[model samples]
Target: MKYKVTQETELLNFLLEATSKKRNDLKKALKFNQVLVNGKSESYHAFLLHAGDEVELGKKSRQDLPFPILYEDKEIIVINKPSGLVSEQTMHNKSETAFMIVNGYLKKKKEKAYLVHRLDQDTSGVMMFVKNKKLYEELTHNWNDYVLERSYQAIVEGTIKKDGRIENYLSENKMQKVYVSNKKGKKAITNYHVLKNVKGYTLLDVFIETGRKNQIRVHMSSLGHPIAGDRKYGAQTNPIRRLALHANIFAFEHPFTHKTMTFKTEMPETFYKVTGKIKK
Candidate 1:
């Protein structure tokens, strides 16, 4: 089966509709890189349709959302992304990432969705996507003025004394991947609470007033409380397969109606365990 394009429906919609009708494997189309548009394979999920676009399901697109949707509204959707998924993909300097998953899902539903903020590849928990371009512009442009707070939960390798504050300069590493900083870098500050201490590790509830690239990772590493399971930092041992970090909540202003919006996500059971207590 096939579909004809329309202004209301996107290319992704046509494929989803067609695939839903058949027992044929949609996952196979996406995984084997079998899907194509206008006689070309397109892995990127946000490929906008301008009408008259042809699609073939080679392998079905993987429905791995990475995380669960904690909250949603007309203006925004808050998702708790699992560890090990990119926020968006890189195509023409763009990325096929988690952001596109939400966008594609809404597109299939005939609604709009756009990226407003992101979490790291290994970082789990709360993230937001805005819909309308106008609303997106407002939130992004006025992010400093709009959002009230953002909080993260992390299990670090060692106990943090004082359950307190840290301030430092941060900058991205150009030669090496993953953002890092030393001195003479942008100012980065993180406030943390040592909620739980066990064995040789500590669980921290972190808050970052400013959104910087890998701010939490770098800052915590510098403070000598590197997040548990972070391979990039001081946690040399593979205690866990993925980093034990998560964004539990993100608060911001509703771009459309000027209302204060707060989104919270629950921690996965693994979040509570460090080295030995992997069982739920």
Candidate 2:
């Protein structure tokens, strides 16, 4: 929706009054970089809108991009982020994050994207982001309802005898290292099914019910099968020379449209090379 201002007003106030949306919703729209002024992406809610200025709401047009666009619509965008890229910048990592890359691509088109979830820096996988605040609020507030299934593919050390599920309480210490705790913590659950045993390593299809920090890494390590190359979780092997974790599948319904959407990615080639042979 586009609005041409006939009188001077602040961007946010004008949006709230014009659209009849709650203040909080309008704030989220602005914070997520959804608002546009005069064909440029604007973040400041307090941005002054002069007479005759143009304002746009809802989905913005996306231009050609340098990176692969796995899927994109007016409501959401899914990107296949490469390994070694942080999902978002942190105090330790200030540059070259996937969020920046996506937003940068959109910025050229005077649009913006906002992340709904994250992937570890060393994990390559499909990631999702929302384009507008209403969708963002609906998805974030009722996350589990929208996300029907999420699965990961990983190469873990040692051979597993059979499929299993790991259920335990996980908590992080002051150093941010996640560990299984009996006395206290949030419940973490991981279900794993062995896909193939190559050489001494096993390829497993992993699924987690809860999105805890390092849930997969910690659960696998507790079973004496830490993902290869995850030094933080006590793996001695670096078979793939990177964390052998990849988010390979997501099945969900659109929050607003309620349309079923499923996405999947093949395991990284490195996961196959170190295992001696790739499974057909």
Candidate 3:
């Protein structure tokens, strides 16, 4: 809906009268960039509106999104990325990446997206991207400092009797497979909590202190309980038909604003099915 301001007033006051929406709902709309003033998004409730200003409600929805957008703002965009799509383009494969899909979405607004981090091709759920170069550089350069939480949910092949932590050095080989290396490699630390065990499979809530290439997969494999469907990590089962690892929760501090931001996505229903648990 679009409204032309006939008198000077505050944005929230104008919205309350014009849209007849609850104040909290209108606040949420503004926070999510659903309100625009003369084409630019405005999130401030107290922003002054003058006569002749055009206010628009409702952001344009993208059609056929491979990954569902969880949140977006002027600085960053978050998505619940689906499995099977690579996070970003690589030299060998340049088509149909999450980055490409999001970039296309932003292009309509005359903006661009920059990759802040990546989730593996088969990993589904929360992924974030920066909108501009300055914020992108700020985030990438000090990622460890800004990132507060990185959590995943996985269904592994065996029944874990207890929760534990795995600490080791990991190195990737020429074939792009990660393995524990005692001699020389980057340190990787993973902590796992046993969520449940169903049949022969175990559901794990995995947290990583150090993000390395395939850290969770390697750590779980080291425990002799590789994530289900993770064939490369020595899993004997492919229950979900895809890697049973999902980056379900991600929280970080906004580099520029210094405010904590969090994004979460529901675990895939297939994960629950594989574990014989009802999705809630």
Candidate 4:
């Protein structure tokens, strides 16, 4: 339950191992509330400790992350996550999540895969994870500058007035759920165009230039055309069985191979069924 930091230890990695939270959860614990540094329950970007900083687990702390892999290689892993599975697990939240599942998979394989990206629990689709040490190092080193062409498909309420782009900053308040803001947040951009309109819902082809959390759902909502079945950001409409978002395609240059690689997932059958189109 405890260990002193060594010269060789990465602080965040140490914290995840010590406190049993994923890197992101530890960031939340540090960034949000409840968890503390040196007995003070707050985060200061300047806070630094050398060898000994006690990480006390809150009474409700636990990490049980879970997720599925759509594709994997020596360089990366892609996940076809189902709705209701979290992308990552946390200490304060003991529920199963995609991160916990990935962690378990890696632990069993005795391999370490760095966290590469995220997807919402209710929005099922493709997510990528890096495999092998060298590739992991390369991706993490250049994540902010990563230039993968990531795209999605979603069914939104009604047809969009026009196929276009949405730009904004996204940040969350104390609740930890992401929120779209005109100011005081990270810059996010989403580009979408209608692919089909049926049964009062429009299926759109979406391209995300920036990967802020829930950018697609928020952007669609901002246009008065929320994603179908998005209970959190949109009206509760059961006509659609699940949050109508799908990470259908990911096209990028493999960091190691420098070759363009495109991975695609077939649209869930429910998506077609809900829209009254049964694929032949």
Per-candidate TM equals 0.70, 0.75, 0.76, 0.69
RMSD of 2: 16.4
Clashing pairs in 3: none
* Shift in Å, residue 179, candidate 4: 3.4
lDDT of 3 at 132: 89
Give one clash count per candidate, in the order shown.
21, 0, 0, 9
RMSD to the hidden true structure, all candidates: 12.4, 16.4, 14.1, 16.2
Q: lDDT per residue, candidate 3, 6-100, as tens digits?
A: 99998989999998789988976764456789987665577789999999987643544544688988888898876767888787777578888
Q: Between 1 and 2, whose lDDT is larger?
A: 2
- Select the stronger candidate by lDDT from 3 and 4: 3
| Residue 12 accuracy (lDDT) in model 3 | 87
Best by lDDT: 3
Between 1 and 2, whose TM-score is larger? Answer: 2
Query: What C-alpha lDDT values do all the predictions have?
Result: 0.69, 0.80, 0.85, 0.68
Worst 10 residues of 1 by lDDT: 23-32
Name the lDDT of candidate 1.
0.69
Q: Write the per-residue lDDT of candidate 1 for residues 23-46, one digit (tens) a residue.
A: 234533432345666665443333
Residue 208 in candidate 3, Cα distance off native in Å: 0.8
